[model samples]
Target: MDDNNSFQTLTDYSLQVFQLCRLLWGPIETPKNVQLINQAYFEDQQRRHLLSNWLHQCILSQPQQEQWIMQNCEFLSRGLLNDCVKFAHDEGDLRLAALVHAASGSNTVRDILRHCAHEDIVDVYSKDFRRTIAILSGEFIVKGHNLVDQNRTTYWQMALALHLWFANSASDSVSTIVRDFESAYQEHYWLEPIAHHGNTKALDLRWKLLKLYTDDTYPIDNVFDVNSYTQNPFDYRL
Candidate 1:
């Protein structure tokens, strides 16, 4: 096989394995210590000592473990957002920065959009968001590789659905968000298992928020009429 084909196969295999692992091991929860440490670590000198102690304990508790599996899993799931931010910092990719910031609730997206050149908006909505979505989809595919003998393709589809939910809701109303989410969900019905699985609490939270914002009006449609401002406008094709 050619190098490109080899890489594609490898990626596909990785995704399958990751999905099995998640299914077998279940969702990882954020560590309380990590949260507390992060809070103290960001404080202005007031909790420096506390932060240090927390960090020390974390290190001493598991010298070989860089972070708890839950935290690691969560971070891995957000790999695309984090990478976009890093790319923005390194290469001044404002469009990427904007998308990442918006998805992550960071102020940088607003800051970038405010001062961005007029032409940049199109690039942000079209190129940047599309690329980010593709990258994230691929990442979930890789995550699937860690799974066991289970059918991990469902997990991949679920991850993609979640990504679509976030992308479609970036700046949309509650009703629009629900519509888009339902469309995405129905697009990949195999994800029903993962969606139904108790492991996807975060996905449930997103669904809950959408329902709350939409006043409990859940759209059961297959087509999503998403707003242009949310993610990329459908008019611009790759």
Candidate 2:
């Protein structure tokens, strides 16, 4: 198939998925599970990544136009800003750090912390936007419905996934499909909440008595220990 045909096919399916995405994304219409929408977008991005590669496969030897793809891919690259900035600091690479900072989602508290040069927990809570601030900062604390909070899972899971994906560039594959997969993951990590559509997923209530972790499924255990969870968490292009 030609590039035009391939892009058409890709858009066609994206539009279909967009409908479902709108619903689970917890649009204001449902006004319930208002917090859990991020998890829904994360899962849907998984499907988008796979479909993206399939579209790419249809292009054959042609050089694909990346404008639309890049538009969607922005979510992934922006999501990595905190990790990228931290990576830059850890290695003391001034150039890399600057590049990461340039692309930061400025509204996020993490971006503010990255620029602030230190994590001031006191100032964070003192502010009216502490919850948004905390997740953006990637603080990873236990609060606000820990046991059954999909928002917490979404923020931390994407945080860990971003860190693990970019930690080792040497072993990361160079295939086109791999690129698409990573784009899917990175692009779905929106700093602001996705509003609109419809949803009602028990977001308001939390089970305080029972512990959330029956197993290691949703481990907020340690930021440093994420590497051991999977050799290659972003290797999902098959």
Candidate 3:
């Protein structure tokens, strides 16, 4: 098919899927409903495969446009799942972490934690460590680099430090932990850069989320580890 025809076909299919999602799962206001809608739409193996490829193409070729299309769609569950899966695999663990964070809620967090406590290598209650993962995930998403190109050394180091902080909370020496986190932020700034010229609004919103954690009182311990329980990594596309 020609580029125009392909685009048209994909657009039509995308719209159809969107409608089907609403019909099957109702309006997609919450993350649970989003997952339910996506699962229902992808019950057809053909759609599950085709939409996965289409969503990846949209993300790699025209991410901003893809985001626009997804936001405008009456149903976002499937599309969001597609986007998350595409980036999760193609973009690496960082993107997966971000998508998981975005999907979280009070109930989701508790459930994830219960599952993680039994299976994950790291302790779920380690607030500092969990918080670091969340922050790194957000940073990775905002930077928009290919997953392979991402410099995760600093992020990992911060995560380790946070884990130590949580593990040895009785010590009460948080200065080093704070410094480590700062170093991670600096590394993120230096390594993965984002253009804030045109998409100021989106950038602003991301910053707002980041700012919410700027204070010391933000409950880092509450950060949920979604990957801890599942044998496979979180792949929304599949």
Number of the top TM-score candidate: 1
Give per-residue lDDT, candidate 1, residue 62.
26
Report model 3's TM-score to 2 decimal places.
Answer: 0.19
In model 2, residue pairs whose N, Cα or C atoms come closer than 3 Å (at least 3 residues apart or on different chains), thus clashing, are 27-196, 75-186, 75-187, 76-186, 76-187
lDDT of 3 by residue, 7-104 (tens): 56446534544543333234323344444545433443333233234334333333243332323111122224344444445536554445344443
lDDT for each residue of candidate 1 in 1-238, tens digit (9 for 90 to 100): 5769656644543444344333223433444555455442233232222222332332233223233222222232333346546656566667555555564664455344333423334344543343343333222122222121123332433343344333442434334534654554455422432222243323332233234334545553311322211222352211
Candidate 3 whole-model C-alpha lDDT, 0 to 1: 0.33
* Ten-residue stretch with the least lDDT total in model 3: 200-209
Superposition error at 93 for model 1 (Å): 15
Estimate the TM-score of every prediction: 0.26, 0.21, 0.19
Best first by TM-score, ranked: 1, 2, 3
lDDT of 1: 0.36
Q: Which runs of model 2 end up more than 4 angstroms from their true locations?
A: 1-137, 140-196, 199-238
User: In model 1, which runs have C-alpha deviations exceeding 4 angstroms?
Assistant: 1-80, 83-166, 193-238
